[model samples]
Target: MLSLLDVFTPAAPVWSVDDLIRYSGSPPSTCYRYLKVLCGAGFLARVANGSYVLGPRILELDRTIRLCDPVYVAGTSIAQHLTDSLGYSTLLCILFSDSVMCVQQARSRDAPPQLFNRGQRRPLIAGASAKAILAHLPLHQLRSIYAKNRKDIASGGLGSDWEHFKRALKQIRSDGYCMTVGEYNPGVMSIATGLFNRDGEVLGSLAMVAWAENSDITAFRTLTPEVVRAGQEISARIAATENMMDLPARAIG
Candidate 1:
């Protein structure tokens, strides 16, 4: 099943059983059975033209899981406050299992026309939010994430230079914030700080994104302290509610 999922990952949103079989290099009978089970389990849906796409069930499950995420539940007001204060778009994102998922977002009154709808999944190695989260991850886990998405990174969907990404993560770890320029979206600049839970475990990241022309890199650097403070404030709130201490020392690196 893991191999099958790996085979389908690149072809997601629009693929067929034949494509899956070809990618997996598996026999027709086995591939058909696997596809049938996946469809029956609501992992895939047959479109009007009989092509397979992701099903609503995956979304439904994703929603359910997100609802239970403490970071999503707690970060809404923080995001709103930050956006309101900074006049830039703010987003709350978490590493949802294997993918980084946006759970909440707030847009400033003068935010850009490009809408960042909730539930969007940006690349972990490219965008500020994902990079902030990735910065604190243990090295082995970071390697795994990079390996899993190597194809996309190599294809230029992520940053143009992989070495630059490595250097950026290192700087993020030292600086307590991550910044990006046109890494995720052209002409969009962003700064991000990672949020922690009661156990000091990285729960997610909070980010502010603005137009490249209007944002100054130095101004973005100045915003880092505020972003870190906000993240810590939110973390303390979660800790008070959960009544636990001693941050987990686990590192993805």
Candidate 2:
């Protein structure tokens, strides 16, 4: 069904049955069957010309994501402000199992870095954004992630062994942030810190990417305090939002 949606884009919003069949790489019968099901569910709209486009269901899902996603609600302004103030790009990543997903990115420039953007997903075993959240995750979860990705963990210099990985995480926790230079992108550096929810669970990571060629590694250290402050501010706001939503339920209980 989603394959049918992928057939339409901003430049070309409408697709005929042949277009859908071609783009979806499915047979005509299967494409028609899926299109019929999706149209019946209000996920696609059919025109008199036999072309189809996204229907109300996509809008409903988009609205739900905008309103219900905590990071988007609390971190957007903070990230945008930080990017504006710093003249650098900032990213907000959500913790999704062993993957760190770039759910929101706040950058002012017309030409942004091509690596991480909204909806980009990367492993939690590398980069400051991933490491920052990993540093704050519960012990059991961290252990499980490390157990599954031992080679990646070792390659990232986090650890070759369990004790070493634990120590790396401990240091990150003590410093209150994680810093990596030329780790993910050569001549590019990133600093990141964890965001927490109302219950103090690790919710996500906030990161800023800067060009190392322009800014020295030592200069990157200067960004730590403000970046951390922005992350904490977003975290607090999200916590308040969650707490308020839980308040009514608590009263009922």
| Top TM-score model | 2
RMSD to truth, every model:
5.3, 5.8
Lowest summed lDDT over 10 consecutive residues: which window, candidate 1?
A: 243-252
Q: Which tens-of-lDDT digit does each residue in 75-106 have in candidate 1? A: 78887898888778888887655556787888
Scored by lDDT, model 1 comes in at 0.72
Q: Can you list the residue pairs that collide in candidate 2?
A: none
What TM-scores do the predictions have? 0.70, 0.76
The TM-score of predicted model 2 comes to 0.76
Please, what is the whole-model Cα lDDT of each candidate in the order they appear?
0.72, 0.81
CA error at residue 188 for candidate 1, angstroms = 2.2
